[model samples]
Target: MSVGTTQTRQGLGSRLAALSRIVELGPGRVDPKLLTESGQLLLRAGDRLKLSADHTVVALAGGTGSGKSTLFNSISGLELSPTGVRRPTTARAHACVWGLDGAGPLLDWLQIQWRHRFARASALDKGESRLHGLILLDLPDHDSIRALTDTEADRLIQVADLVVWVLDPQKYADASTHRRYVTELAGHEAVTIFVLNQADRLSPEELAECVADLNDLLRREGVEDPVIVTTSATTGEGVDELKTVLADTVARRRAAVQRLEADLDRLTLRLAKAMPDSGAPVPLSSIDDARRIGLTDALCDAVGVPAVGEAMENVYGVRSVEWVGWPYSRWAAKLRPDPLNSLRLGDLRDEIKGLTGGSVSAQAAEVDTAVRALSDGLTVGMHEAWQNGIRDAARSRSAELPQLLSDELSEVAPRLDRVPGWWRLLLVWQYLLVLLFLAGVAWLGTALAYGVFGAGSLPAGLAVFGEAASLPWVGLMVLSVLGLGLLTAVASRNFVMLGAGNERDRLEREMRRRVGTVASAMVIEPVERELARYNEFYSALRGVRG
Candidate 1:
């Protein structure tokens, strides 16, 4: 073989390796039939390559009454394959081997029995040695009345190293033959040959026209640079030229590999046609911030995050009032319900521990909507099979979603119970103001009782001042004390509520962060994994085509 041809075969070997990778990665995302057929072809090609690179199995395939058997006998120089006036003479495949060495395994692989096998070369037949190592097969007629013959012909045609289509003048332009077999096998031009049998039946002028017309049809059908040989099987015209073609093909010992390369090309083309025409997908290793936020928000809706955050705020505000409100009126704050208790969030550790089969506060419809939205966005412009495969991947972890979300809620629960250290300080200060007010009230009441009843003089410490001045100063002191206490209470209310609002914001942030983790594990990671698989499959298919 030439260096260029050797390089081509090496390239084909790489392509076969790529095809094998594709089969490994293409279960759910590809048609099962395509995968099965591709896998079988690869196995068959590997087996053939390992058997005998020295022997080239060339199958002569044609429709009924195409003189295919006559050409086979003429080339073999023996009547191994029967010829008759019957409509379908070649009912079964017959193999003619030029050299018998190492041909047993190949014939066995081809499923040709011993009765149908013939050897053309021997010590006495030196002239036939030129075509040594050639295994010629006369396949059953493709258009025979029996379905078995058609199936057998197709089966042999696919596995043959080279296929020489026998076409006679009367049926050369048969539309069914061209459409069903000739055009469909367009990629195998390297391992294909055409024989115009019974060419002597037409005049020379007619023969030239027939050849030209056939060439034109082949070109229109996308068969490029095809090799055609003219021969009259009955008269033995051009039989030597056919032998020369066979000898040259067998000499190179590259037909088998070339045939496999063309097979890969055809299979990859089918894959390419079945795939979406969309451009290369944008690589996504992880979810972007926008998508992350969207997912988090959706999950929050599904799990009632807003309601929980509001409840935390209400609980904070209620507890703040009970701790720091006007001491005498703080009793009223205790009458209100604890929002956290109502939501079963007051003791989340116990709740989680007791959960045997408890679900999260997630809504089924909302979760479905969120997951569908995510899958749809990720799989835009993909093929339906691919889209379904990715969607299924995204939901692969769905059965664990309830438990995962429950864990998130449990994780964020302790944070809600946390109270600021400053709240205690404010509580102490409020009580101090109340104490001063009560002491002032008691002193004013004692002086007023003594002055109004005139039962006794003021206490000794107060004797230095006149009665009017003492009474007025004591009343003013009481009023001033009460005013200060009232002012303190009013001012502290805003600060307490502000603290409560901050706690609400913190709770919401923590919950969102936890929910984001669940979203990633439950949806984003699996979807990205499937997309990566698809990209790998696509790349491998491209390698196969190359």
Candidate 2:
């Protein structure tokens, strides 16, 4: 169900579920102190909700000498409660159980002694028999001399399923009673009753004035739709009316549910106001795009990808020198380090890697800065608080991020070992040309020795290079060797340059993919989880409101 809708026809099971959920939520997302002891109240109400209370436990509570006991006696039709001029009489609570046999458990729970409990079957009076399940209580005076008497009365008020506040005509508008109890119980007006107990003490006009004043006082105290009945314990003027109210309430047997429902409603109001509005549904951008550009750029800086790319270009140049340099100079080129190897990247034979060794850890600030850059775009439409929170959540795993990037980059970065097949073919052809050049040099030298000093004998059929002829044949062979070798070097340099550009593109794309993966894992998921929790909190609060 949506959070804004109220369930008017909510059943018992729904109430139980709602009440249980409030307790389950407890003080986690919200502060418990702001709850005004609601957690404790909810627990107590939940326990009460489980009981099968057939009787509507109504308490007659009032101040000193208000004739509350007299009213209780008139309702019970017996002198069960002590009444006198004695100030603040009655210590503990006295319960009157009507037409109920197993009220023992409930009375015990109310802390009323079995000795103070009395039962009336109501069969003696046919007209008043409808008050059968009424467990009317003559509570100790709330303004009692003994502090414990007032404490007992206050405790009983909370536990009683229904309450009838008895007051005298003179003290009906008492400030203490209005401020202390009545106002606090404004939420429970559904299960509350108010009575001017000593109504016969005043004339009709004065009594009417008192009732009107009491009603105004109650309204001021925030109690809406109050039921104010004028009662006379001695003259019995409004005693029957009060009895009828109890009879109507007891017949319905809904006072307990109403009381608990009011408790839940009151508590929910106190807790729900602290939450921020969810507002309209705005589209939230995914973290992927931000990560691809922002995080990847940071990683490129920290991982030295540009430096690596430059070294790769230089390594191709180094290979060129080795391929085309004079024989002695070619050996000297082999002695120098391949510029790519100077990067200190750990063995990347298996995976296409971006960062290796401690390269990522060296410039860790880049990774940290990525959060700010990425979050600037990711949380564009979010509130300031939420944007900061999301940014914090995304950067929360910055400590482990470098190592994670290193591992993931290894899988995505272009492999350095990938040499184009054409480059290898060119290298083989160069080696064979060098061999041909040496063979040509040997053939020319042998002919020169035979023609000049006869240092050795030469077979007359052998020709230098291909077929020895006039027309600078020997010079042509010499030129062929040197010129073709230089051309080969030029071709090799162009081929590697093209390969380097392709490699750079592949590496950049791979780095971006890995960066997005890491950012989602470390950043986006946590914030989204918090969002999910907020929604649940909102749902539970709504469930409780219902």
Candidate 3:
């Protein structure tokens, strides 16, 4: 064999190994039958190639009465293959070897009966050493009446290193079912031979027309550089040309490798059709964002975030009132509930243990709809597989979703757990203001008591921390203090309500972010991993064909 051809086969062997490994890693990604068939073919061909490096196994295949047996006998110069018009003449295969040194192991593998095989040197001239190491097989008629004959022909055809299809002048230009085999072998042009057998029956002009017509059929099948030769075994005409062609092929010693390579190409192409046409996929719009929003919305509903926000607003207002409102109203403020305490977010696991929260169906359905939309860009089968993969990814941790969400909420509760220090300052200031009012009222009561005992009429001259005691000034001081305290209470209520709004908005943003993380880690990552594996398999298919 030429060094280049040997190198090509070695490269192909490496490609096959890589493809086998990828198939092992990615089971069910393609059809199981296809995988098994390709793998078995690879192992079988590898074993055959290793058994004998020099022997070229060429199959003489043809339909009924195509004169292939006569041609086979003519080539071997012996009556080894049965020939006649008794319908199915050859039910099994007959092998002829030019040299006897190593043909036994190969013929044994081919399962040719010992009596059927012959040594070419014993029958043909001894000068035919140029065709040494040639394993020529005369296979049963592919269109034989006996089912076993046809089955044997098919089995031999698959294992043979090269195939020479023998055609007669009569059927050369006519349409026949056997022609389909030649057409399907377009990729095997390097290892295929088309012989116009029984050429002695036709005139020179008729021969030209038949060969031209057959050439056209080959061209249509994409068999560029097709090998077409004419021979007549009965008249000993053009038989040497066939022998010379076989000699040249055997001398080169590359037919077996070429045949193996062609088979790999055909199988690789068949398997490649299952993958995506393009390697670089236009990314499907990510549902990660939408999914995050959906999940966060669900979890927030379960945790009652909106309800908590409202409570927070009320708690803020209540605390504000306690800090700066009327003394009696402060006690009323103590009766209201604190929003944070009701949420049970602090040590939330034990607090909300029995909470049977769940995800909403509408949200999950929307996610499913978006995922199916991605399939519009893919073929039907690939789309189905992708959809199934996505469902598997999502359901990986489906049972833990609620608990995960609740735990995540607890982890984030600290963000909202706070009380402003300004409320304390307001409380202290409120106390001072109330004390001023009480002091004024007490001083007025003392002066009024004196007036009731005939000293109260002189109340305007009463000294009360000033040069003169005046009811108007004292009453104004008390009223102003009360009004300032009411305004402070109002301001505190608005401030606390504003804080509650800000807290809700902030928590929503963080919650959505957390939801996105969970979805990606548990779902999106797995789906992308599967996609990456498929891409690798596609690349491997290209390598195997190359």
Candidate 4:
């Protein structure tokens, strides 16, 4: 990963951490896969750079015959490789260490062990004496027969703290080199340098004109005031100045650290863009919530709790008794039962579940469908939003990304909305109702027998009826009827509670799934898309810079 990419990753990682914290407090947890993808990408980018506190490795990059090796030799005062007129030379990379006591640590970090060392000549060379930390690399020809050499060059550039791109007057405007490397390194302009090598080959006036043209091209590629150095290995012209620049870069150890930090900063900005705005967290418009609430409401309407209450009153109205102490007058008092006690709300759960289709699996399926529909709607809305932004951005030169995002998002909408299976609340309610009905019947029978039989006339062996008869039979019958009604009401309330509870749980699951879909579409997927775009843009940018 290059510094720009590394920076982008760090930014994304921070935002993901923030999102993870938010999810912890949310009603549902985010999917592990989503979290893992976000974390792993950033980690991988960070790992590639071998970032540390102490050192920075700068790479020298250029096309064939760009005089990169000659420049490298001049900078470190070491003839590490042969530099001559050849179509393709420097088949391998050469590293030169200046003034550094040990090459082991720096080379080890750069994954390069075969390097040449140059010691300072004198104290008068003090301006260049501290070249110990400077590691000058002579990379293979980028436009050569060996494709792997080019790949290696790219890899080295990504790992290097700073890059010095060499270019000669003749091929300065070469399309392949500029399009492939210069434009792509836009964000790292501070850590990048473009050297107009072989300046000695041209007259002073010609050199000045070439340099001017090159600077203008760089500016167009998004590099503002790029450091343009003139150098000639053949004449030793500007060689000392280049050395001074390298020495200065070494003295400021912060350059490498700053380069890495800048990478992190840029990555952070990209990741921030990927994340949803923090103001008002978007509530999930999931199908599960919609389905659960919709289906529950529909089932309730179907079951008719009020109608059940009315029916119970009509059927059991004759069971109530009044004036418990006036036992003899009980027969004359017309008995009436409070219908509320017989209304079994518990029975409604099973009925509702059956009517809606039973089991959690079925309910889950239904919820999935509802969720899919909601997702589809959301995708359409997002597509419109993306398209609108793209058009607006295109019209305003202020927009950074093209309308490609809108088209890409629109293409992914269908996949995101794919729905999956249903689960039901009626089964639980039915079971509760059955239990309540049985208990009611038993209580009714006991009340009747004790009221008619008299406690004293009961057989001596059957003491169970003693308490049953001792209490005013009529009053007890009235109380028994009331108790049965209460039992039914309680059962009804329990049915509603259990059903609602199940629905809430399903809603939570659906909400999580919905969030995962959205996150994947908006963040992970977009990151991948942007990565490709960045590569293309960077390649073009580098070309122009060269």
Best by TM-score: 1
lDDT of 3 by residue, 1-546 (tens): 668868977886777776676566446566787788777777777778777778889999898888999999998888888888786787888899988887788889888999888898877566388889899999888876785434778888888888999988777654553465776677898899999998888999998999998888788877887899999989889889988999888888888777877877777777766654453452343444554455445545555555444444444454455554666577764666642344445554333332213221113433344333433332234535544654565555555655665566555543222446887787888788889889878655655555333353434554453323455677788788888877877776777778767876776567556655765665556555655555566567667766
The weakest ten consecutive residues by lDDT in model 3 span 354-363
TM-score of each: 0.85, 0.77, 0.75, 0.51
Q: Which numbered prediction scores highest in lDDT against the true structure?
A: 1
Per-candidate clashes, comma-separated: 0, 0, 2, 49
Candidate 4 residue-wise lDDT, 81-106, digit = tens: 67888766787677766545554565
Each prediction's Cα lDDT score? 0.80, 0.69, 0.69, 0.52
Candidate order by lDDT, highest to lowest?
A: 1, 3, 2, 4
- Clashing residue pairs found in predicted model 2: none
Kindly give the stretch of ten consecutive residues in candidate 1 with the minimal lDDT sum. Answer: 351-360
Instruction: Tell me the spans in candidate 3 whose CA falls farther than 4 Å from its real position.
Output: 17-37, 100-105, 121-127, 148-150, 268-276, 279-407, 410-440, 451-513
- TM-score-based ranking: 1, 2, 3, 4
Off by over 4 Å in 1: 1-5, 146-150, 328-360, 398-403, 414-436, 457-484, 487-495
Residue-level error in angstroms, candidate 1, position 508: 2.8
Which of 1 and 3 is the better model by TM-score?
A: 1
